[model samples]
Target: MTRPRLLINFAITADGKTSTVRKDPAHFTSKADLHRLLEIRKRADAILVGRGTLEADEMSLTIPAEHEPAKQPLRCVVSRGGSFDPGHKIFRSKGGAVHLLATDPRPDYDPAVYEKSGATVHTGALPDFLHRLRTEYVVETLLCEGGGSLVRALADLDAIDEINLTFAGHTLFGGQDAPTITGALGEHLPRSLEFELVRFDPQDNGECFLTYERKR
Candidate 1:
């Protein structure tokens, strides 16, 4: 099977927190970290995010000019409810193509609606969805910039090929029930999965940028 190589990248606090108690997106990404992230995105053929992330962050999800790939990667969203904002800047960007994967049974949405706005929407099962990404879209490497639930799902399915985590030394200590980067793994990760620390640099804001990779 020609499965796409999945790469999960995100920054977390020292206590393994991805966001702050106030739930502000700015708290999660620092300026230095953002530059590093864009560099990573430039190497991928597609970037994936969950619906909740799209709605909550109102992400534009574009690669920076200095790091832009020859062809812009496909922007993908895993939307179980089709609740993402069509007006988000990612859909408005003329830089790349956008693809939304929803489970909603409504065929009422005209692809042209998003197409006109600079995006394309598709719906299907997770595995089949990935297959389409690999075959139909010719995506060989997929980068997942996540909201925890999506990361957990992909990890549970054992679909992930690598994980690149940048641990920031800050904490989003309290919230009603905010998400974490890696949540509730039913069992210990397989012994086959081993992480090697690739880089450790200090950010201007007094946070550390740590990178890890899955040992194959």
Candidate 2:
């Protein structure tokens, strides 16, 4: 419960699909929303994404020099299988630390695999994993740019302090297999978590940005 403040951000289609049924990177959100992402990124002490997001988006976790924080937030990723290509852009080009949170530490987990790629790998329970970011990395504010599963876990853990969602109004990626943020929360009655909407920006391009803060 003492983990750093977490913000979850994502973009979805009108049909509530974050991406196509193929699970590819989303390009449906407007450029202005992308700028909004960078603005949010500039304020965090660390940025986290699931390995799927990194692989699909081919993202570099740093911001422009003008927007970089004083210590530059670390580029973070969580991999259940602890496998990632050394050639990913975040490894080759991100401006600060590359930290990998591992869910499974097999005997064959070679430090060099993540190390040579510039990531300091971590393995532990989700809470302690996040606590390390706060204590060891000095990450006071962590931003999660999600792939649905990661968002679901954090939401299930009641770890998210805020949620930022963009509804890109022009398309629909409809598939019974695809779900939006907070994916599938197993068999249970609907869980009610209250959030106070803090901002709503609707653009002429049919993009709507909404921010919600968990009620304490």
Candidate 3:
């Protein structure tokens, strides 16, 4: 049960959609939300994302110099298959060590390929990988910037501690295929996980920032 304090940061449209039906990059929020995101990210020892989200966002996964963070957080990605592109921006970016967790074992994928690129590849269940992050990497705070499916997995494991969200009321991506914070309109989580709203900050730009702490 020992693991890092898991945190999720997501921006949702008025219709509660995280992305377009095509699963586009989440750029609907304002500059303030972007600033808020980096502020939240600064406190994490590591940042995690599903491969789809990572690629969609084209994230460099590094704090900007202007943010003045003490050091960059480790960049981590999870995928069912270990098929990451070597030319991905994350690999070329200068930041903390990269760690990839391929939850599903595949015979054709070679971990050595990524190792040669300086990324540590891990295989196993999400819970085990998270536990390893805490014990081996000493990650006190683990931030998950989502694509939803990954969030659902964490929720199923009851591993989430804090949820940070920005409600962008000005935009709406209403489509049956559009994804929500948990994922595409689908089955419920294993069980209801209760949370207490700890922070509610409404902005003048038709947006609201909210933070919830897991009630446990």
TM-score of 2: 0.93
Q: Rate the local accuracy (lDDT) of all candidates.
A: 0.74, 0.82, 0.93
Which tens-of-lDDT digit does each residue in 76-139 have in candidate 1? 9887766666677777666557888876635565556666775677877778888889999889
Which rank order by TM-score, best down to worst?
Answer: 3, 2, 1
Which scores higher on lDDT, 1 or 3?
3
Residue 45 lDDT in candidate 2: 88
> How does each model score on TM-score?
0.83, 0.93, 0.98
Candidate 2 per-residue C-alpha lDDT over 37-148 given as tens digits, one digit per residue, 9 for 90 to 100: 9889887989999888889888887788765456567888988877777777787784878888878766777767778665787887778889888887778999999888
Each model's total of backbone clashes: 0, 0, 0
Best prediction by lDDT: 3
lDDT of 1 at 105: 38
